[model samples]
Target: MNGPGCAAGFRHHTRYARSMSGNRKRILIVGGGYVGLVTALRLQKLLRRQLKRGEVEIVVVDPRSFMTYQPFLPEASAGSLEPRHVVVPLRRVLDKCDVRTARVTRIDHARRIATLAPHVGDPYDLRYDELVVGVGAVPRTLPIPGLAEFGIGFKTIEEAIGLRNRVLDKLDEADALPYSDPRFRELRARLLTFVFVGGGFAGVEALAELEDMARDACRLYNEVKREDMRWVLVEAAGKIIPEFGEELSDYTRQRLEERGIEVKLNTRLESCVNGHIVLSDGTEFDADTLVWTAGVKPNPMLRDTDLPLGPKGHVVCLPTLQVKDTPHAWAAGDCAQVPDLAKGPGAYCPPTAQHGVRQAKHLARNIQRVMQGKPPTPFKHKNKGAVAGLGLHKGVANLLGWIHLKGWPAWFVHRTYHLYAVPTLNRKVRTVVDWTLALFFRREIVSLGTLHSPREEFAEVAAESAPQPEAASRTPGQPVPKAGAPKAG
Candidate 1:
């Protein structure tokens, strides 16, 4: 439960009081996400002397204790990589800073205080001289019927694992029944029908990788055939993988369709209640699984604060990544509408890992400059390229907005780029090892669905073997005491 940089115990507001001797300034970084982790690490390196002398204290608060390298999530779910290698523990990485597992409920900039609700214990106010908002975004959802109950989002590792387990579990269930049985026909059709909404990178890559896994897994099931499964991708847009341009997007769609995936363009999912999918084009089907990766919206926590937000509910930030009209507040990553100076006026940086990492570097330097009583520099950068993998040894890419590549070369670029981009050398080495071993061995197809409810079997056995209460000692065949009256007195 404890790690380096973690305090031993909790206290009231007094815990954030400045040291009587040095009067150090406290910098509270909200959200242990891509931007927050990078910013905190860079700040620690920049303020090493101040940290040792107690002249500066860096505190990072997030609901999760680790930062997930999201790019590798699809591969993780496909069992081509280890899930644990895709996340880095904040406390271990930031040994000099404080990493608190808590949610920042509100920020009162006027009072220089932030309200934090920890995983345990009471809520408290922590005073800070500087604040960095990087709470990140959540899945953008619509008011579609049954979406909340039936649809899954491909945002986190847990969701990816759950999807993998659920898919495999369905396959296992379908295998137990004879194909000729009526129940088998219905169950197999429903179980193998997977629907994915959205045409973006997350949705496309997830569908591709999972489809690859499912096809490979079919070889192990005697009753299941790869052609029997149906994979559907519905996008309201005109094309998928818009980041890679029209050529690559078309190529990506063609590749998916060649693999028997139904790529429905300009089609919206009207409803998916009770596994019944109704599309805008009047197409109807039953699919037990539906993945929603339509888009992402800024963290709703910004609504609780007084920070100025843009039209889309993202924090309004200047070119310098400083919150508009607030001197001490700063924001970046998906939560901030950062001006894209490279694209000129009216253009903001896209919310991607590349921009988030770059913004963190700039934000750290700017914070240090402000601390030294110097002016901050504006953040300016242009997108370099984009890459997307389509299963094993297949992909599409566009480099520097000029060079386009597809198939094996793009796949290599996708892996090479992400392997280098994922944070931490330890994780990088582990992931590479996973890939190396995978080359020599087949992909692991075993599903540990029981991990979701490890106690279910034991609970069932306990209930079944539990001693039955003695029946009422009455005449044999006497009507079982059907009344709430005094135990058949």
Candidate 2:
């Protein structure tokens, strides 16, 4: 490991020596996503002795302080789960490690330093002996017109809750207007229309869950009817959820269509300027809500580092999960192109929660081996199948290759897998409580959009109570008149 770059990094400055004083080595993990969080948890247990004796240090850096469990986001958006229970706070879980709420601006592996920028403080440099890159992917957006200004993404917990508010608020606004009014004909239709541009799990599941919730909500409104709403799903590929196998993909499409959703396959979105959509199939319409979940790309921050990257802007990793030809640097998850040893020479593992959790454990064990002057082992995990939920009691799952289930059976499996996967026993209990309570009562349909602008009312009151300027009739040296006291004519 003592190559030219590695040696220079050690000798670049005295800060490195200061950080390593008393033989304590710092392991810097650059992300707080699923992989980073899991790796830190495993390492804290595996290196318990070193951490206790001040011989090792682990630091996790991310802009946000919590790690979101993304699989349950659909349920949260549909009001089946509370938004607060969908994220795991890093500080509460990693008691033995240092958790820094900051973003990594740049990485200089040649000097073993990383630049960090917090939300409020100035940027500073952090030195580390071992590095892990797990900064995950961002939404893959197209150059289509109006997408940046109009489309919403379904990535974070905040976004999921915000989408819920937006949908319910739209229904409320449309219900208050008169449907027979000619002037509101087009506006009412726009308010009732919802468009989703993606057929992947995130897009399909979100649409299904939200649609079901909205349909149930219609019963509470006297003016709103379920038949008046329009739901359209547009996919560029010939099929939706290609990873679910051809048979299951067809089944999912049929289920969605049975619920009055228009599935447009082999079609593309041309434009959506000013809420007017024009598709590649010449279907033009007006909609108030548009969601983009097409795909995701690797974090762009990798370009600013000294690591060797793959052609698709991902860090290249060998089967052992080490950055190709770069010592003391490792990467996994969506940001790294880890060779799939289970699939043979030319294949790579798909970016999913199943692969990520297993890789994190393997990487943690490998790091301990390297620290003890032992060789690292390769990471290998076979693909387990995929499961997805559609609305309330409908779903589909393909386990291994021979086991196929649909409807209630698949939905139950979907819930069972994610519930078992969510970190921390505290969170698992809270989530289960939410689900249990939901069985006796209907899902909440109230929209809390005011949470976004809670200070607006206070600001308005403050503006009205502000002191008024002195009257023009008063002398220059005289005392100024109080607000609302009296005004000279």
> How many clashes in each structure?
0, 0
Index of the highest-lDDT prediction: 2
Model 1: pairs clashing at backbone N, Cα or C within 3 Å: none
Question: Tens digits of per-residue lDDT for model 2 on 150-251?
Answer: 999999998999999999999999999987788898888999999999999999999999999999999999778889899999999999989889999999
Candidate 1 per-residue lDDT, tens place, 1-489, comes to 343323334443345454422468889999998999999999999999999998999999999999999988889888888899989999999999989899999999988889988876666778889999999999999999989999998999999888898888878877777877786787789988999999899999999999999999999997788888999999999999888888888989999999999999999999999889999999998989999999999999999898999999999999999999998999999999999998999999999999999999899999999999999999999998999888988888899999998899999999999988887788889989999999999998988988989999999999887745645355678666565756644
Error of 1 at 169 (Å): 1.0
Clashing pairs in 2: none
Q: Please give the TM-score that candidate 2 achieves against the real structure.
A: 0.93
Score every model by TM-score.
Answer: 0.93, 0.93
State candidate 1's TM-score: 0.93
Ten contiguous residues minimizing lDDT sum, candidate 1: 3-12
Candidate 1 Cα outliers beyond 4 Å, as residue runs:
1-22, 464-489
Residue ranges of candidate 2 with Cα displaced over 4 Å: 1-22, 470-489
lDDT of each: 0.90, 0.91
